[model samples]
Target: MARPFRRYSAGARWYDVLSGERWVYRAGRVAGIGLMDLQAGDVVLDLGCGTGLNFPLLRRAVGEAGHIVGVDRSADMLAVARARARREGWSNVTFVEADAAELDVDGLRARIGAATGRATADAVLTTYALSVMRDGAAEAWRRAVALVRPGGILAVVDMQPPTGRWRILAPLARLACALGGADIHARPWRLVARDAAPGSVREAAVRGGHIVAAVGRSPGEVAPTARS
Candidate 1:
């Protein structure tokens, strides 16, 4: 976490500009959130939220009545995220500055309950954040899932080497992932498929499969129709 946070600190101010939000990474989150199919008044957790790039899309889905809990370890990145919420006059958004790997689940639950009157979120999302967690990725993912209620949504959007004709851009993709402290080979979205209710998984591949998004209901629910 510190390694990625180190790079994030130096680039936090310029992240939205240089992070390829316009032409690249944003599409992954869009696909992932779309698969989540969030409803208005839902309480969603944005794990490793960074500079709140996902805020606009999430706000649109959940609307003003819903709550967003943005979690990240980097103070610099959280600073930018806070600025975004403030600038947008988003009163429903709260932030927790903590490493997802070392998060105190009970403390987080209490906080979320206090903020939104619910201990568990309706859905939890992590976009382009897990692979960068390196050794702590799985632990972080576990803690994230614990913060959601049974049958809540789980979504992951992460990177991998491009496929098909986009293979020609693999080197550039690797370079981008390296600079961002991500492991392009991680394929973290697999966790969604693993934990999803049977036949409930929804998936999409964007940016020629370099960016893959997977979403599904967490355990404890009857399976729903699948989509891909």
Candidate 2:
């Protein structure tokens, strides 16, 4: 299926607005920070890093010697990220334009190797992006997993179905997303949770029970992996 997020290049400004007002985005950033467990010289990947909202956070965690790559499908979004990087003068960061589902893992490793002489990531993060993938959420998860070297981590934070009887609230959330020019219905949070890989799932609620943040690891330290 054609994903709604692929249309996001045109809606970059609208997304920025939604992210600013949404508590989910805030919680996701916090959760991503905790899950990343960054250290000096660590290499990190921020998949679907729209407008580099979390770049500053990642930059702080990684420090001067660390490296961060922010990947997004939208050139428009990447433009914003680039502008931010330049404005902030963050020399440790690089932004790339690419689809998450189709990202070339080896090519990415090669680039990182050239930059840092390594083929592994200390952390990989995807915030509010996986749930909207056109490929099934599982495929997205698998692709994300493939990016990490053994024992690395993948962390994802996005809007999810409300826990318990709050299911009726989804419509209101959808309406709010629509007002911001986003297609919330295109990303089904509950479906992503249901399809998540076992043995590595950790989840939490945000926005007074309106959104969720989930983290999955590749059977190792808290560094972070996944799709929806």
The most accurate candidate by TM-score is: 1
RMSD of model 2 against the true structure: 4.6
Give per-residue CA lDDT, model 2, range 1-228, as digits (tens).
Answer: 254664666667666675554444666688657755666677888877888888888888878888888888788888888888999998888777877777787887777777776766666777767656645455655665665665565676666445557777777766655443444544434433443446666666766455566655555433232211
Question: What is candidate 1's TM-score against the reference?
Answer: 0.95
Query: In model 1, which regions exceed 4 Å deviation?
Result: 222-228
RMSD of each candidate?
Answer: 3.2, 4.6
TM for every model, in the order presented, reads 0.95, 0.79
User: Once model 1 is optimally superposed onto the true structure by TM-score, how far is the C-alpha of residue 48 displaced, in angstroms?
Assistant: 0.4
lDDT of each: 0.90, 0.67
Candidate 2 — what's its lDDT? 0.67
* Per-candidate total of colliding backbone pairs: 0, 5
